[model samples]
Target: MPPETTGRAIFISYRRDDAEGEAGRLFDDLVRAFDEKSVFMDVAGIQPGSDFRKAIDQNVASCGVLLAIVGPHWASITDAQGNHRLENDNDFVRLEIASALTRNVPVIPVLVHEAKMPSADVLPENLKDFSYRNSVELTHARWNSDVALLVEALRSYVHVAKEHETEPIHATVPVQLPPPQPPQPDESASAKSRTPLFAGIAVAVLLAVGAGVFAATHHSQQPAQTAPSPVPAPAPVTPPAPESAALTPFIGRWQNTAQLTPKDSLLRLVVSNGGSQMLVHAYGKCEAGPCDWGTQPAIVDGSKAVTSAYQLRNNPQEVQLERSATLTLEPSADGLGVTITNSYQDAGTHPPGKALTYTFARATGS
Candidate 1:
């Protein structure tokens, strides 16, 4: 309904059956921090008989960030697929979350009241650790602070969006990228000059070889000159060997598995079925060296694996080195692609606290 570039439009997803008032309040608060057009809500924007689901889908797809307002009954709702959908396949929440992810959009989950956060057992393996702790309280003052903090964070992301949309920052940031050097005439000239030197060396070698041959032939006749022994053959060279994988997972703070937590760091992984859940303990270490040996708890879900030691802290040392992956019996490139972030120290940081994220390929080996 409104012009898009409204600065990273915010999409709020909640169960209309549970806390409609809270969802509405959140939209109002977010609007105050952003523009009216930057916020999307069905009551405010969606028209009747205009394909509400499709409209929600499109808005969710277009939004730069999705805010999941998790209330007591949020996850209890059943979608058309009869699945408890929240940002996963067939789940509107999943659909919206996936779209944002695919478009590089961020999804922020805001828990209100007594709602239970989704754990590995209830959610797709990819989203298990994304659940926030008892991050939000229902109290008015805390709610206001949380909302304000979220707004501030959204604003920061919007600033990032604005900066990225404008002229590329890397282009103006005084990078060390060297300008392309023009072809030097001296290189070609040098090659040409070396040709004569090579010819001269060859001639000298030939003369020396001929002299030796003649001396050897005449030595028998003159008993004076002796031919020098032929030069020994040069030894063969060996190339450098590949690195070993002995010290992985412990190289530094690496995610023991796909759950987005640094290696060797302490994390609590809750795997649940129904209301019963089991806690899987793990540690994180910084991924470094070929072995990434510093990574720990080598055994995860009966799987023995290690994480890439690319991100020592926040530096992007390796592109193929996924910042994190989940510990599972069996792993795949896509099955475990969780990444860990270290922005949980700030009190007002939206989602307040943080947890290690792990990705899963299949359900589990066993």
Candidate 2:
């Protein structure tokens, strides 16, 4: 309301090869807590053929905080040759982070997949400070709790920025009226000036007569003053309202978004708990029959699903954690079906597996 300063946006920096999946998941979570426009990631917003260096500088400059996503190989990732990628001067990750550090923005190191902070000796001269900053970790064992803490720390900056955006900008411009002409012989300006002067004298005489008449009448002593009342306790803070159902299009059931048979694949989406929580049940093809992967929770954020569910293998041979999977949906043009982005993290690997996508029509009754 007061020119919208003292607030800032969030800038996320991560390597596509290092922690792209985690970065995307973090973006969705932040979007739910703050405005979508305020939580920005280059993958979803950047257009082609533009000067990316300028874009990185602009975004970093406007941000109040920057999240540096560090994975196990974040420091050691290599390009086509054998050399480490971070050594390159023109690397986008290095450029954006350098900008934030130079501007004194709060740079938060986000560790994922059990990554440790890179020592100052391992980092470039300008980026060495990144190792000393306090960091937060997002672990598979407790993703929700860890992120909640991070969000709590970020509230001070985000709430102000959001309030600034929600304020209505005044659009009425003042009109400049011409000055009145000099009061010559019988100009209207002189008549207008005389009107208020005469009105003032009449108002003063009326007030004097009213006060004299009141003084003549009886006057009594004022009543005794009463003691002040005690103050009431402040009310408890209520949580903000949840996202509207109209904005969340994926609020119903649908058979395998991949459209595979029970023998090959079987999955269903049951959006319960007011559409904010989801139960995903699925089965994969195996020897003899389908492997029933039990149901698990996937937190829904608008059209996207920030899944914490693990796909378990329930086959004749054994039962164990197969892969951690995330299911995100985008409805089709005909409004009859949705496209799904099924991303997963493998059991043995720490890095997330490539996300697989599928499109299917909404399933009918049972």
Query: What is each predicted model's overall lDDT from 0 to 1?
Result: 0.48, 0.62
On a 0 to 100 scale, what is the lDDT of residue 261 in model 2?
50
Worst 10 residues of 2 by lDDT: 313-322
User: What lDDT tens digits, residue by residue, belong to model 2 across residues 153-210?
Assistant: 4643455454433321223578788999985676777777897989999999999999
Number of clashes in model 2?
0
Judge candidate 2 against the unseen true structure and give its global Cα lDDT, from 0 to 1: 0.62
Task: Quote the RMSD, in angstroms, for model 1.
Answer: 21.1
- Model 1 residue 223 CA deviation (Å) reads 99
- Residue 263 lDDT in model 2? 37
Q: Which one is best on TM-score?
A: 2
- Candidate 1, residue 350: the lDDT equals 32
Q: What TM-score against the true fold does each predicted structure earn?
A: 0.39, 0.43
